[model samples]
Target: MPLSFFSGGGETGDLVRSYDWTSTSLGAAESWPQSLRTTVSTLLLSPVPIVLLWGEDGIMIYNDAYSVFAGGRHPRLLGSKVREGWPEVADFNDNVMRVGLAGGTLAYKDQELTLYRHGRPEQVWMNLDYSPVLDEEGEPAGVLCILAETTERVAAERRRAEAEAAVRESEGRFRALVNASSDVVYRMSPDWTEMRRLDGRGFLADTEEPSVLWIERYIFPEDRPRVRAAIDEAVGTRRAFELEHRVRRMDGSAGWTFSRAIPVLDGGGRVVEWFGAASDITERRNAEAALAELNATLEVRVAERTAELQRAEEALRQSQKLEAIGQLTGGVAHDFNNLLTVIKSSTDLLKRPDLAPERRERYVAAISDTVDRAARLTGQLLAFARRQALKPEVFAVCDSVRALFDMIGTLTGSRIRIMTRLPPAPCFVSADPSQFDTALVNMAVNARDAMDGEGELTISVGAVDQIPALRAHPAVPGAFVAVSIADTGSGIPRDRLEQIFEPFFTTKGVGQGTGLGLSQVIGFAKQSGGEVMVESEVGRGTTFTLYLPRVVDGVRPSDDSAHEPLMDGHGMCVLVVEDNPDVGTFAVQTLSDLGYRTVLAATAEEALTELATDAARFDVVFSDVVMPGMNGIDLAREIRRQHHDLPVLLASGYSHVLAQNGTCGFELLQKPYSVEQLSRLLRKVATWQRRARIMSQ
Candidate 1:
């Protein structure tokens, strides 16, 4: 069947031989009829990626599209058996070609095929078709094959089915999650009135679409403006919104809820839906507020209790201090009484007219000096007890110490070397000038005792901005003028330091110490908003530091100028009410000697009896402070009722308790007074009575 060259044609129209394309296309160049080429080419070049194969004993060559469908197979696979061309698909290809050669058509829609191209992964999905090629005599010749790639469409359909399944499973899980959550999950339109709350039953049916008035009705009135503004802003700006407000319950109780919303935007960026949650935090909020209020109340109570306890402790300390002073004074007065007896006997002997004048003068001077010494002792006791009134002034501490140096030199008994360490700048404190001097003298005496009159004593003064241990002591913090008295002697033991400030607790043996020294220092410091502390070692020495808060502008000095002068009582008759017979007898005798006629009563009843006898005879009534019945002030009022012109003087050992009641207009004198004080007080009362009588006349 080769083409023949004919002699009948001209040179331009030379005869050509017809070439066989059957071997390249259908695996047999002579077997493939020309009519089959057109049909196969048209189908392979269609819109969907398609391939064509024709075969005799193997696959024929296909179009470029067909080669791509095969994916990296050689284009020269013409006349090769389909099994030889792709051995992995050999059985499948053989079966497909056998059915087509047997004149049976085969079709496969959306079949997934996997192929390796150059050892790289390739996946293809195709609609496959195989048909038989017939000869002119109606006999089977070869197989025709067509492939259409459908990978993307098949994958999309599979993903859609999986997504639908996932949605169903997630719906159940999400419902459980929302139900278990403490917050109330919800969906709403942009208007916020149409809220679909998601409970165990999907969303609330009533709120599928609600009118704006529904939101207004549910919202708290006070929160309406803010909630409205937030909604408006969120809708206008297409942004998320949040708010916290109280919601009224069906039972009329209000509870707080915090709500938040996130807007779901459409493709045009307009809010289409809102997803939000609200939490019921009413109990938590209420509990927090209540706890805060309770904490504040507790804090205030604690502060008050602490202050009250401090006041009670201070009162106890004062009481203990007074008791110790009383005991010390009582014992010392007994000893001094004995000494006074001897001194009085010697002075009496000297008072004789036959005695030598010089010897008498010496004896008289010694008596005067001893009396002065006794006065000084009583003054010290009063100072330590804080019973004496102070005349406070802002004075330089340096001057006070310097003035006391000479006195300290004499007091230290010439055995201790006195040293002074004064600050370069003036350190000032507010206190009575005389009492301040007395305090320093008392400390110096104590130092003398600590050193046993043989060690070095140092008095130092300085101003400090802070004391390190003061706050720990529960003391005030401020500028302080520190006056330190240090003794180089056997130091106070650690355990006895706090006890030293307690009254009557002394380390010194009897007759060697009064123990009022450190107690006075402590009381003075406390009254001045300061404190006292001791630093000591076992064998070294002890330093007693007295801190006094410094005043910036200085306190005004007190005037003691109003004190009246002493007078002899020669013209007055006095009524004395004393509960104790010994004290009454002593007062009667003392007043009789002072030239005052005395009427004595052992009790308030006896005094009332005497007053009933002759009320006008008494110019003044002097009564004991404490009594079995009807105290001195009450007795004085009874006496005044009968004798309105009578002047009263109340004598007491318990001066502090009497003064606390604010009973004024009567002269008060502390007990254990001298003969001189009695005479002077009587004269003042007599003078007052005479003046009153003159005014009435």
Candidate 2:
């Protein structure tokens, strides 16, 4: 039974002869059965790998090819049992042995198995064919296996199948991306001749047409050249291109689009294809354009609103000016009517043929007093108008207040208690002393009226370093002497405080007050480089503070000549220039009564004619300051030029020209003058002219 009996001269035959098989269940090779020997000889002689399992143990026998398949276990497995040789595939081999010993054949194509080869476990596939080897009597004997390892062929086929599946999945994802996109995705040939494919059909009106034709038709005519140029450039240079252009939509409406593409290049540095996408940007562009238009409209509207606001402010100012003028007219009419009543009554009373001397004297005195009061009233109006001429002098505020206390008490009546708080030292201020006294008296009377005739009126004088409340006042910032008149009386309302300084704005009932008192006080303070402030609350008393700029210089001496006896004109010729005929007659009569020979002229021009006719005829010219044509100041200037020796006196009730041009180097006397006052002014001018003439001679 030794394989030498059925000799074969191959590598497997030599390995079988050298291998020790006595320890195996098949026993020594020479003890092997003849049938097994013949099967081994036949397997050894085969070209493909073949193995034979003999007897009940299914002892292993293999050819050279089979030995190669056995890898590192070949020599040892040559005579071993099949299970012992390939333990990993033992159960499979057992089924093959069982079926083959039953005289049946078993075959498997690409059967999978795990085997120990080269001393390590390996996964392999094989095509196995099993057949039974018969004994001498033709009973079942052994299993003869013909096998081919198909590991490499099967692995290659599996790799090819996986590759195909991956390609399919990748293409599926790509198509999904294209179909789901909002932008139109496209590919074009390298020559830019045609579009290869396109996705996102919803963006196109004619999906069946080529992309180039679609673009030509749907794109705005104006944008065709640029889009064509961009595509050409991308193809020529093999570079990315981007552009934004207008497109005509399917609805025949225009919209905007942004298109971009990158050229695909081949290894030869030639353009292969271009991949591109176009996005709808119509809404964004429209919104931007609308915002620009809205900004322009907003600018125009803002300008219109600003102009309207300016116009409203100008109209308000004009309305306030007109109201002030009406108030001034009303107040002037009321006061003049009152003065006329007194004068008319007195004149009518004097007209009685048998009037008693005492009654006549009393009427004349009443007329004189009323005339003075009227002149004072006109002066107050001028002061409030800022037209009154000021004769400023440095005076002690404390001393002035002290001197006026008794007079203020009398003016307030016995019902009001007068209190004075004067600083220890004199606080000097530069102002017209008379106007200052008038301001004080006006404030006191206002307080008395507010108190309803029974309240304490406290007048306090002090020096202030800084008055924060007067920061906005027109007065220059500096030290000031504050004369505050506070009254324990009904306070002014908060809403009416700002209007209190306006002329004719009053709380007193009609006919009770002229409403010019506080206005005049405010004007006086402002004109004297000062200001007035008031603090009041309902149910609390009001305090009015007059802040006059402090004077650092010595007090000016008072004029003692004011108390001088009245001097007559002594029959000197006088020329009276007045605009009104009745006023001209009154002036002429008044001068004549003052013992002057008077001539009447209704205008400054008429007065100039009279003086030109006989320059030396009139020793003095007394002219009203305001007239139709040339004013009193102009007449005086002409007289001074022609008749240098003549004396000129200018008088006015209220003259804007006088206020603007000042006295013009001439003497000024307030209007509605008493006969005595006229006599005194005429005498003073005549005397001064006489002395000047004597000195010249």
Candidate 3:
């Protein structure tokens, strides 16, 4: 049989074909049993994010799409136990596996989960589906999982809900303010004796029926006498009655109001009735009394009043700045809408069964392109927000900057003068070099625009012992490398300086800038254990300095460019030891896919057990540096003490023992390694092991 089911989805499909299933619970790839093989093939070929859990342990096998979904735990999570893979959500997965293996199905929409994908707890929402993958015996064997992340959609919906609530609240407040302005209307007989029905509109008690003793009911007794005098004077003159006096308000409080009435005169020169309006003047009256009292000591209170006004002004400014949140969401929604439009249109067109094949391909291509754009947009957002998924390596900042000079020069227009200043020695820092390069390029492009394609832009690097405080954060004293970019152009305004780092906030004209560049810069800097500082003098120039903690020792980049071509494992046995269940699973699976025989051990003790079984059979020991009992360094030392010719390669994101005692002269690979990185490192280490054994002979 061709076994064509394992061929062609993408890199993931290729992995499935190359993987050695004999090392796993599923047995050998060629002998996996029809049902299991078919399920594995479906997992590899699916465009959607799907995974297959084989056997009781729920060993994981995910497609490329799911690799993206796995976040920082992708390659390493491939062959790990599902429960051990996501320890933060172990209970959740345990329930899933239990139900699934029982031949039951489970589904959850927008199920919230907190996972430590990048060494930090992140709240995520997912639409999950799980069903059993039956074996040839028609019994429950493994689980099939389909997942869709809805975190961004949830966030957008929340933002929209908040925005709508704000609008409704604003409308309600406006209506209330208009009502509270304190106005009313009423009609009175021309003689000013009886009053017609009155509408209080909140100023005083309403009069549903005409009343004769309106003054007694609606006005204060003492004020009524004065009101009567003013009314009589106006009525006798057949003119408007106007008087400001105290009244019985609706709440039964004696409050001041300004009341006015106008007499309606007949054409025959006789008055008919009076109509009037009133306003609550309680606050104004109280203010006038306070003003007179304060005037006696105005000089003494002037300074205090000024200070209060200043504080109020500052509060108003802060409130205004918070309104930028709407702009940020609006920008994201706008970009997502554009991407969705393309997908929507393409799918709609594709629904026509009789559509031409050529047009069908075109529409499909369009959809694929839109999805890619959407993925890039999502990555950009992640970079700006958390940047939790970081792959750090030790590299010299000065060397990296020098390598990017040509690219930076190209980004800033030819008319601009690009110059560089570097220290005598290489300034080393442990960080994600790709993100570092991206941040530098973004700053360079920003500089190019600031200069309007013509000005001097200087890039400099130096070692610093401390970082001066940036914004409100306290000054940090440590070994740091300062990479500063200075531009001689129109400087940023003091007012706009604080907002420049805000997502989607831009001073550039519309269609000019997305405003995500600086946000990414700040995100990368902060996530890399550093900070970015900006100093701009209006009309003079601007300087942006990024400070990252220096890598003190054991600073060396992986020699990925070794003089060896990519090679297959060719059945060389390897021992894999990792306490992080997820990473351990992925490591074993990845090496097996590379055609090596793998034996997985979750701890160093287990690894020793496997080594003791047949120490000489294993060509290399691949282990994680940070484990629970007996760290990778001690394990390596123990292995060296017994099996002196065995090669042990360790991996980690960070380890206290490794940092304190050093790599112990053993090779080390960083965490979040790619298939290629793992492959090359293993091949190199295995080659050393072979050479050592040959020398022993």
Q: Write model 3 residue lDDT over 419-514, tens digit each, in one string.
A: 999988788998878779888998998888888899999999998999997789889999999999999989999988988888667765444435
Question: What is the C-alpha lDDT profile of model 2 across 512-592, one tens digit per residue?
Answer: 546899999999888787888999977778999998889775667876556777766678888888888888888887766
Off by over 4 Å in 3: 1-383, 389-394, 504-514, 551-563, 573-594, 597-675, 684-697
- Lowest lDDT sum, 10 consecutive residues, model 1, at 8-17
Tens digits of per-residue lDDT, candidate 1, 1-697, equal 6422222222111211132344344433344465455444354345443334454564454545555565566443534567777776677888887787788998999876666655576676779887777766676666667677788998898899999899988998988888788666878877776776675332122333334464654567888888889889988887778888776544557777787899998999777889988777788889989999999999999999999999999999899878766767665766588669868877788868899888888887777767766655655555556554343568888887888789899988877999999978777787666657766887788778778889999898888776557435654567988889999988888887778777666665555456677666665566455677789897899988887777664645653423556554665778889989899999988887767788988889998898888878877898887898888888877767777888998887554445345345676665556665666666667778899999999
Cα RMSD of all models vs. native, in order, equals 18.3, 18.2, 50.6
Candidates 2 and 3 compared by TM-score, better number = 2
Q: How far is candidate 1 from the true structure (C-alpha RMSD, Å)?
A: 18.3
| Residue pairs of candidate 3 with colliding backbone atoms | 76-586, 79-585, 80-585
Query: By lDDT, highest first, what's the ranking?
Result: 2, 3, 1
Task: Kindly report which residue pairs in candidate 1 clash with one another.
Answer: 22-28, 22-29, 23-28, 23-29, 58-81, 59-82
Compute the lDDT for candidate 2: 0.82
Angstrom error of the Cα, residue 538, model 2: value is 3.0
